[model samples]
Target chain A: MSALITCSHVDFGYENHDAVVDLSMEVEEGDYFCVVGVNGSGKSTLVKGLLGLLKPTAGTITVAEELKRTGIGYLPQQTRSQRDFPATVCEVVLSGALSRRGSRPFYSSAEKRMATSAMEKLGIQSLQNHCYRELSGGQQQRVLIARALCAARKMLILDEPITGLDPWAIQDFYGLIRHLNREEGVAIFMVTHDVANVVSQADKILHLQQKALFYGTPSEYEKSPQGRKFLGGGDLWE
Target chain B: MGVIMEMLSYPFLVRAFVGGILISICAALLGVSLVLKRYSMIGDGLSHVSFGALSVAVAAGWAPLFVSMPVVVLAAFFLLRITENGKVKSDAAIAMISASALATGIVATSLTTGMTTDVSSYMFGSILAMSPRDVKLSAMLSAVVLGLFVFCYNKIFAVTFDESFARAAGVNVSFYNILIAVLTAVTIVLGMRMMGAMLISSLIIFPTLTSMRVFKSFRGVVLSSGIVAAVCFCIGMTASYRFSTPAGASVVLVNLAAFSGFWAAEKGIQRKNKGERRL
Candidate 1:
């Protein structure tokens, strides 16, 4: 399948410190690709490079479409900033719609309807007016997901979307990601530390160890050496 | 009461009172967002920068308005860009520039001789020194800040809460952040004549902190902060006039009183609620 996002021999760093080195990967259209890695594994760096938030220190990166300005929804790691920020859910969701169409004087009715529909799709209609900070961790994730849904152009890029959530919340979050992928066909590129929890839902798995170690279906990842190590040396429990 | 009546009768006194009211309202409104986003130091830094600029203008015999406002606004722009680019931590940039600005103002003012006629008034604030020009400028700034806050309140809230979320959703977080910074610059510029550099940050921080203790929602915080600030300005101005004290100190003292009152009342209510539940 043709790729929606492609990174060719990319090198990225921050403040003269290299985070990722000579990495290459591809994200196809309609792919729910979960990027799994240990802490400081440059998972977030890869996502940032892909989103053009951080330009690669070396090599060429290209996407199928003009991705720079087009709607690429992002869920950052620190959700507290969004939580304590003084904005209602509807206003936040409408921002997603705005990102898709930047600098527009106003949002059209259709865009408003789409944002509302996205919120409803995420089953957060009642949260439309709630202050984001007041919500539980699970509810906040759903709201952020809804916001991403409003703005994402055929794909969403989330950085550890399941952190600080309980098991039920994580399950529900996974369910929501799956629902977005299966029912709506929105591609997902999420960097996750909870490899096992999200493994079942991830359509394609991209395992990173400072480089693209494995990029294929979950079953294929299981056969790879790193994946075997990840799964506790083929015994399945570590 | 008689002294207050007499002070209220004077037009300049009334003007200063009104000016303080307007300034307090705007500062408090901006403070809500600033404190939430941890940009309280921005207010402090800009106030110092403006103080320096005003001192320069005074020493150079130029209109303080033209010199101070632009300098602080430019500083605000640079501060926002630096912080947003993640080149320097926001607070660090603020401390560096603000300290330098304060030092520059002190040195410049000290270098200029023969203008010791109530310079301390400007240093500590002399609301009574506010001319018609100052009142008009304060009113204009208050109106602009209030108008922009209304029109872009939603967007500003979005950006302040989560710039990434706002950017992801399609909000131009950079522009909004700059807008907030500019507004803060304006607020500090106008506030310098009344609140002074050393005490102005409290005008931005205390009202918000007090309101946060009592309010549960965004709207509640904004409205309550505005009200509390207005009252503080009024009482502070009156107290300064009656007691022949520094207007800036009076205003801040008034704010502290209001804050303490709110805190005590909130605690009292919570204790009563607990006792009722126990019963």
Candidate 2:
């Protein structure tokens, strides 16, 4: 498979110091990639760099032409203001089509269909008219995933997707993500702290601590010293 | 009926109603996004900046709206920059700008205008302040604000809901944010002649809060906020006419009442739901 995103010796940082240094990674098409790191380990910075939100200080991070046209479906962490925001599920889901609509004042019929099918795929069709703030945490996450699906069908980049979820919800979320990645062949790039749980599902892993300590298949990651140290010792940090 | 006829017979009163209702609608439409973004105090801040600009205009013998419009717009952009920089908290930045502007306005007025009724009308607001020229200007600007809000409704909703996601989706978040600020600046400057700097922000805040107490959707809240604001302005204007009260204060009191009523009704509904669940 062709690489969807290729980064070569990428460095990202603020004025004072570099947050990510000399990072090299590739997200191949249909790849289920998990990036694991402790807090302040530059996972977020790398995610921002990959998504083109932040410019790399050095080196090139090239996105595939097709992926650039479709855009990467991005699911950012929820903020405090979003919890009580008064928006219908349908409205929230439809907003995912904003980039695609591009200069259009309203969502086109096709965009509407995209949102509708996304909701149906996520089994949130019944909740489309409900208030977003009134939904449970799992339902809210499902709505967001549906939104991400509307943005792009090729790849999804999620940041800390399962935070604040119950154990059951976390498993359910993983199941949904797995179905999308494996069954639908949608590439998954998730930045998460649940390394122990995700290590079992992820095809490839990138262990980071300001730099890529290890990058390979999950099995190789398990064998690598950095992964063993992180999974065994750093698991407690979370 | 007689009071209504008497109030309508005066051309100035007619102008006030036309200008006031349009400005109310503009404020309410922009208010929904502002309230959701936690930038409700932005209206208050911009109005203070407008007050400062007005004082400077009065001191310099320039037309108030002409002077305040550009100054307030610049202040709005400056405020957005300070908040986005992450060095100071949003509320603290607003508070700092608001207090400094108000002080500058007060000093400027005292040093030159000496708190003249003309300046005080801009501070406390008067129905008589809506001159024919002001009404015409307010109407034209209100139309622009309403048009832009409708045209950019979806983008505004996306930006307010999630800035990061919007940016990721290739929406220009900063551009939309600046659009919101500029629209708000224009609405505040237009409404300030009738609502006053002190109470103009109430026009931007109360209707949204009241609508949110009952409405569960962004569109519903936005529509309801406009209706609520317009209706309240009419009621307040009539009451001000009959009671010889300040127009701005009267309008604010009406909004406060509406907010209280909605809050109580929401509580009642919640209680009823809980009781039904118990059964």
User: Which candidate achieves the best TM-score against the true structure?
Assistant: 2
**How high is the lDDT of residue B112 in model 1?**
85
The reply for model 1, stretches above 4 Å from the true place, is A1-25, A38-42, A52-70, A104-116, A127-129, A234-238, B1-8, B56-63, B81-100, B107-119, B214-220, B261-279
Worst 10 residues of 2 chain B by lDDT: B79-88
Q: Which digits, one per residue and each the tens of the lDDT, describe model 2 over residues A1-238?
A: 9999999999999999999999899999889999999999999998888888899999999899999898889899988789889999999999999988888898899999999999999999999999999998999999999999999999999999999889999999999999999888899999999989888999889988998989899988877777877779435444
For residues A51-86, could you state the per-residue lDDT of candidate 1 as single tens digits?
Answer: 667789998888876455456778777644455665
Interface RMSD of each: 3.3, 0.8
Which candidate wins on DockQ? 2
In model 1 chain B, where is the ten-residue run with the lowest total lDDT? B113-122
C-alpha RMSD over true interface residues, model 1: 3.3
- Deviation in angstroms for A108 in model 2? 2.1
Candidate 1, lDDT over the whole model? 0.79
TM score of chain A per candidate: 0.90, 0.96
